[model samples]
Target chain A: MRVDVRALGACNRLAERGAERAADALADLTGTDLAVEVTGASVASGEDLAEAFAGRESIGVSVGLDGGLDGEAVLAFDSQQADALLSLLPGGASMGRSAVTEVGNIALGGFLDGWANYLGQAIDMTPPRYFEADGAAVLPDGALAGDGVFLFESRLDATTTDLDFSIYMLPDSGPFRDLVVGKTATAATPGAEGAAEGTGDAGSTVVPYESLSTFASLAKRGSTNAADNIGMMTGLDTTVEVSRLRFVPLADVPAEVGVEPHAGTVFELQGEPSGYLAILFEEESAAAVAASMLPTEPDDPLGDMAENALCELGNVMTSGFIDGWANVLGTSIAHSPPEFVHDIGSATISPIVAELGRRQDYGFVIDAAIQTEGVQAQCDVYALPDERELAAALSRLSET
Target chain B: MSHPSSAGGRDASGSARRVAVGVGDLAVVDGDAALTTSGLGSCVAVALVDPTTGARGLLHAMLPSADDSQSSRPSARPAKYVDSGVDALIDELGAAGASPNRLEARLVGGAEMLDLTAAVGPRNVERAERALADAGIPIVARDVGDGVGRTVRYRPNGELAVRAADGFERTL
Candidate 1:
């Protein structure tokens, strides 16, 4: 729809001022010099909104808006920045969840309070709900379910802590447009009207985020099982940290994975919800893991024995991961034996992504980091669910 | 799967300029300049060069057609879709003093980078091929498919180099 640029600009300024006040509140709370500025404000569809966060992991806090408006307000931080912020608070490094939530509450509360003052209306806000997931998963359900949304975004850059975060407000387009432009409901923008015309199409069906979360939890269980299996095999204390599932643009995959050459094992899941998985390790990490898998320390770690060990490790890991999906979904999930490749990390995964890209614009990526105690080895496990299979799996979840 | 040939590095003589063509964008250049675009997964890069005049143009188009509602809008960017983008590129190349009859095309990218089951890459390739055929531009060589993301560099001298994510580079 044709957004009134002047009205958008005014709203942007108001949001920026509100964020500045929030920055003051944060500075007083943390005793740090912080700056919050309006970075971007626009109107976009759900797909385009997802594209803005393609391949990124974020932690967000969303609060429902009630008085004088109908929408959601979200404040998000990149995973790295969130970690940095977490480490700044007292007992934060060890117990970050509560502290992070507290921070989100204060920051977003102050922002909404200031905005209410600016608009001369009492804006009632619900308690903030903390979400640590990929960008796509964390987007408010209202935005995804609607044809288009009004996005007002701001960035918080903390100088002392060196942490950068973003705050977003997504308002239902109809009311937001009226509020911003002071226009009546009858004067709908032509663009919005056109977008509304295709309301009942198959493509517009909303895939509930709750169903996706079910799959995410299954992925977490799989990672944990894989971690246990690895620990048993290598006799090393291993732990898996599974990140939230994210929808990533196919073109941005290489950069997202750190485009260096890595040794990888590729596996294809064959079943109702079929997909591909790639486990990647940096050269040094591969050598370290391979060395640990060996019965005795090898003179040369890059030998066939090491490669075989890696392959076996891949097989065990894939089984642990996929078996969890099959069990939870009540379906059979078969997987191909791992195929090893030593090349640029992106190149190894590109073909798999290409296979998916042939059909869809975006692919789902679930990243699991495998860490072993006292070993300088780290393995990244990536799970890409086939689009059709993903849909089927989600539908089954909703049905059950 | 052939070993990558040495093909992508720019000339060190400091004479050639490098121009990057972003997604949904096109550019035409002459002389020692090289036009490049990266992160091409499922999107096709149509590079046109006139051998006689040393003029080259690169169009990075994301979708197959401009028949969508968005494109129907007057504010739509022409270079975003294959149908209109290819035509725009040809017009721009002609504006740059290149003869449309003498233009030779090289297609890169349109690789399926995700297992989405739709075959967007092949469709993109097909659309581009159809558009170029309609425009009467002959495609000399192409590295269009097989599920690998590629970065393409097109020189005015008709040297079209494509480098896959594996660091495998080949001149087509």
Candidate 2:
């Protein structure tokens, strides 16, 4: 089914509004100041979603939904913040998991209320189920089994206290598709713009929902190609850990990539789907990966020789990345020579995102994580494709 | 992974209240409180401080101007754009009992970080400077136009500390 860009933007905005409302509810209940720091609608495979929260220890509540929406929603708290969150409850720190569950229930209710109001139908929710484990375990079973799932994720922060939480909504494909399909159909009807009126520019392309999954697979292949190139260059066993497409607000792009210091190379892709690409590694990983490239370990991992080696690796990987997209779309894609950068993760991406933010409020970030088996070496490859051009390319692929 | 502590409530003097200003957001505080924002690349952090009144406002803006944005209407988050964000910061400090004429601006961030791209960093810095100039607000100090990301912390006492990712720290 085709989904109009306008409809998706509207849904994204609603998700933000709903998360804000949820934060308000939590604030009201706990008597603490809270805010929604970031919100975005994303398309990712189960493995990608799992990988996102796999390492961190978290506690959360999951609930099933029906009526206006059919899906499962998970509200997770960083376990370290659990004490702060628990302290806000009337029962105080002694309440523990039950209080956490109640907070989740109220926040999810407030969250779904916006969607329900928009759909003009009540969304019934099942009782909250509490889960405490590593990040991925918070998600219900079978959530990690899908090829692609539409997810609305938001991060909430508390101002007065050191508390924060994340809400992840996994909507069932059939019902979610129907929702988008219906909204887009209405958006296309003359004089019935409704929800889609204020969101999109005129003449936006409509992309088939399934095509997003195809693009995800395309990203996976590209990342796999990159991993193979890394293996060939470093002679280390490297593999693609996760690959997914995330649609996020332009302003949040930097924070999404993260704030930690990173060593990377940046390139600009020039072609049918011209955009920017960044291949980043944590400091230690960068050192390890760079050292593996040279005959002997470099005296300084970020010195001239290591920087050149990393740039060369980034060049081949950039080729491996866009080459998949180029082959599949039957178009030629060229990339600028790499620009070596070793700085805060967000700093490396904000300029690119800011440039894109001038014309588009949202960005399609194709993210991939590559890991070397025997060392503390990991790489994060981000490919931000020109949204309109990518939509056009994907639509053409669907047509074929 | 754990979040980077936006909580910088402790200093040499004593314990102070801390507020974090996230991306495309702003915050204003008075008295023994500090305002902080981090991970600023091309995004500019504009701080308005009234040393006389001990009131301060911080804006973390991503884009130069909302006028240049695709949307024609004013954004709900006015602080997301520098021109409007500076205006909002001035107005907020005014509400906090700091006279608009008494406010002096100190800027941080606006780094290009990566080379040969659209010059959003320079544009953001220029836009902020113009906005402060237009409002008859003088810019007291600034640390900008570099290839680095910064985390900034401002206290009402007129101390604006900026720490670059490369372990360089400066008080503007």
Candidate with the greatest TM-score versus the true structure: 2
True contacts kept of each: 0.09, 0.70
Candidate 2 lDDT over B1-172, as tens digits, reads 0111244345445778777787778888888888888788989999998878988889988899988887543456678789988988887778789998788889888888777577889899999999999999998999998788898888657799998998899999
> Which residue runs of candidate 2 sit more than 4 Å off their true CA positions?
A6-10, A16-40, A45-60, A76-104, A114-121, A130-147, A155-166, A181-202, A365-367, B1-14, B70-76
TM-score of chain A of each: 0.56, 0.83
Model 1 TM-score on chain A: 0.56
Question: What digit string (tens of lDDT, one per residue) describes model 1 on residues B1-172?
Answer: 0011112234544567677665567888888888877667677889998889898888877777766423222323467677888998888889889999999999998776544235667877999999999999999999988767677888657889888867799999
Question: How does model 1 score by TM-score?
Answer: 0.57
Q: Write the per-residue lDDT of candidate 1 for residues A232-347, one digit (tens) a residue.
A: 87778987766444444443355455546577588888996787888888878888888878888877775687788888889889888888888777788989888876655654
